[model samples]
Target: MSTTADRTPTRHTAGVFDIRTIIGTLLGIYGIILTAMGLLGDPAYDRTGGVNANLIAGIALLVAGLVFLAWAKARPVVVDERELARGDDGNAVHEAR
Candidate 1:
């Protein structure tokens, strides 16, 4: 049986969380909340001009969410062997045999 260490080391590229992705996720949640409130006949309607606020917010969230999702999916997550090989000083030091 091959152990995890013996197996190929998965590359973990740094760009896991992007600003746009985080913003999109938060907006999505906010939009969902507004949508739910609007649909559930919450008092938010009275404060706002009309139900359009919720509708627009929801649509915007859905669109942004999809876009962010696509971007996150498209960006490749690669394990950087070169970076790993390079030490903190950006130099590869090999021990003398």
Candidate 2:
């Protein structure tokens, strides 16, 4: 006799270890640093043809990071305990050849 609890499946999500999360975090950090430098440091107009390279790059990185983070949040990876427990034969117990 199986109870409701026994029938229920166990699941978990990939949180910090998710690739998107890692990428997003890295991009965000770089963005903040670059953005700061762009604002505080010299623009070096001669190098980039008068364009604020650091500022532009920093903003781009920030936007990309946000997008990655949002994507990760919207679609989280789910891991099912039961699926992991299954053997090649699709059963909990492995069959001997």
Taking all chains together, the TM-score of candidate 2 against the true structure is 0.85
What's the lDDT for all of these models? 0.61, 0.84
Candidate 1 lDDT over 1-97, as tens digits, reads 8887655643564354555567668877877877776566554656776555766677777788778766655663444454566545443321222
Error (Å) of candidate 2 at residue 22 is: 0.5
Q: TM-score winner among the candidates? A: 2
* lDDT at 53, model 1: 73
What does the lDDT come to for candidate 1?
Answer: 0.61
Question: What TM-score would every model get versus the actual structure?
Answer: 0.54, 0.85
lDDT string, candidate 2, 1-97, tens digits: 9999888877777778789899999999999999998999999999999999999999999999999999888888776667667744444322112
Question: In model 1, what are the clashing residue pairs, if there are any?
Answer: 11-79
